[model samples]
Target: MGERLYLYGIFPAPGPQHLALTGLDNQPIDSHTIEEFTFLFSAAKQERYLASRRNLLGHERVLEAAMQAGFQTLLPLQFGLTTEAWEPVQQELLVPNRDRLKQLFAKLQGRREVSIKVMWEPDQELETLMRENEALRLERDRLQGKQLRMEEVIGIGQAIEQAMEARKLDIIQALRTALNPLAAEVIENEPMTSAMIYNAAYLISWDEEIAFGEQVEALDAQFEERLRIRYNSFTAPYNFSYLAQP
Candidate 1:
């Protein structure tokens, strides 16, 4: 049996070009052109493409290299995507979806995905909330006198939780307000950590990349003491590409 093709992404056809890139197991990366689209892939054994950290990183590395090579408008395939051979990709993926692919290629041209994550210093925020909340102070005083009943303790905990949720929501909303105008599309992701107020990905045009960065820098300076804003602007359009998947 032949080795499966590990699909990385699809890019606009650049005629014939060399990608000085390697994929899983150090296999040389190659491309197949179908019409105006080029599919980036590498040959690999099924076992080598398992959902291991190494394989996942290999998939991202290939896409990253493609992006760095000036393929700004690209669609990244999900990790672990493989085919028995290249023929199926053409008959099933390319031929059937040619029109849609072309449309997406035009729509996504000169654009890239950017991710922004916002986090607040939990200790400082919590301290400030506790110090300012009158109800919380009363509750703390009630608990200080003697051994607290279960309901009393539960009430205090609930208050803190509610305050945290409200703060997180406000922070997320403010961030979206500051960033949405600069993006063609916005996708909100779940927070990966308790300290994370928001995690969002923005589809930004290459022409507006500088403007977007400047906006982020402004927000960072505005919230420097309380919230930390971190961003990455060169990633493949993974969030937007899923909508184009067959």
Candidate 2:
């Protein structure tokens, strides 16, 4: 099969720049300039580039290097994007969407994406919910002295599950309210696991990063006993980068 360019992302063209970065198959990372933008990509065979963990991590490594090199407005391409040649990338993607891309780049200048994930200990939250819920308390009391029927046990479990769901919603809303003001854009992602209450991405400007971090620390301190909060702030703006499917 013919070689294709595996795309990582696009950034402002850094004049005479060369990154000591490697991509898929340990290929040296490079770029192709088009007007004011430079596209980062590496050569790979189609089959090898499709969702392989090594290749995917290689893609991220290249983008991370670009970020370190101080390309402020980087737009990450979706994983597995490939084109037969640079001519088609310019003709199909760049030419057709130059103005829109320029606008997006300008808007994203001096900004970066941050991800937040919140998880709670299910047993702890369930115990707290049971204590606060009269129905759950009564149900537990009812079952205390007598043998519980299968349906009764299931009912109590279901009630706890429902309470957990509601609590998750409330916490997610509170998180959005607390963090939205510091972000240029907020993207709520699907929870990755049963214990995950919040999974979101924030596009935050450089000037506001300190404040944003402070707010997160405050929130963590506030909920330290009930929740586990984790964040990553130095990634490329993947959530806001919406290019047409190629």
Candidate 3:
């Protein structure tokens, strides 16, 4: 087909015209100034990009570099976003949403996204739940190795799953309570696996990053034996920006 551009991020205009970074296909990253905002993108030889591990990391590399290249603030675009030309991107997406984009950029300035992932052994959580929730424990005991009808087994399984979800929610709330005071915004994304009890991204100001780390350390110390608590303090604020989809 004709030319295509892989969009990465947007920040204020008058940024370095050259990104000093390479993105997909080892292409040089560059900028296209649109109004008061500058859009960062790279030329794509492929018609479109698939979300393979290599391709995804390549996309993120440029976005991360965009922030590191003196502009700490950025509105990270979605992965695999492309346009044949900037005309459509401007006429439809950027120009229409200019004000909101600027406001988001200003709000995101001086802040970075911090990620926290807490995972626990599912078997352990289940055992704890069964012990703490007597009704669930009784249900599990009643259903254990029983020669029951399909519907009866399914019902018992559903009940156990519901109880497990409720327990996960309580733990997520405690995690939020422990970390919310240090964050400008906290977003709880759905846990991807049964072992995941918490997956959240926090917008933390640069000045408070050390305090945030201390808070996370205390939380980890509290649950060191039971849970796997991990945090990364430096990333573009995607969750709290225009890049986030409704």
Candidate 4:
């Protein structure tokens, strides 16, 4: 019988071996040779094949195994990738997709993905700040006094609205400046609370991950009194489009 190759996502050499421990058909692929690194893939006819949930889990398992093995992988065609035999996998996928795959691998080489979410929790201090703002407090006093006409009351309401808007802007600007050094790409999401501004960003790195985390933590600590933010990091799946094409 001919050898069947189970294709896992592509990666650089030194891939994980225990990946075979997580079976493809609930059976492991054959061992790898000393000279070449091997990944696993299931061989089924492409013409009638479907990417069932079972296949998706299998693929995820394969990638997770690679991560555990200390190797990063990019599954270019995430799901529904198939071949009838090892030769087809080598010829159709490994050969034709070789350049693209290599490019993606190069782009992601030594880089990790980090996510940051900035939120504000309403605290007593912020309320105190609002109360201390002379303009807003004065407006509240004027409205309560019942000494103003309708036009004057409208004016007071407008003044209070403007003051609140300024406060929000001031807080957002502070966070933007504080976060400038830590993020590669920053996206502002809807505010989490009346007091909190949301800034979500993805940071790319290989060596700077530790420094990046420390920086974010420092920011959190520094702003903990008025603003609170947190961050998380994860391994990115391989993608080809992230690279600029030649």
Question: Best candidate per lDDT, number?
Answer: 3
Q: Which residue pairs does candidate 4 place in steric collision?
A: 6-40, 6-41, 7-40, 7-41, 8-40, 120-196
Q: Is candidate 2 or candidate 3 better by TM-score?
A: 2
lDDT of 2: 0.82
TM-score of candidate 3 on Cα atoms, chains taken together? 0.84
* Model 1 pairs in collision: none
Q: Which ranges in model 3 have alpha carbons more than 4 Å from their true place?
A: 129-167, 243-246
lDDT of 4 by residue, 1-246 (tens): 454345556555545554555545665543332223355454432344356888677666666666656775443334555444556556755565667656766666666556566655445544665677976776676578477888988887687667656766776676667655665545455655565556455545656767777777777777676656667655444323243346
TM-score of 1: 0.87
**What tens-digit string does per-residue lDDT give for candidate 1 at 158-239?**
9888997797777777778889998998999998998888889998888898899998998888777889888997787887
Winner on lDDT (3 vs 4) = 3
Ranking by TM-score: 1, 2, 3, 4
> What is the lDDT for 184 in model 1?
93
For candidate 4, report its TM-score: 0.55
Q: Give the TM-score of each candidate.
A: 0.87, 0.86, 0.84, 0.55
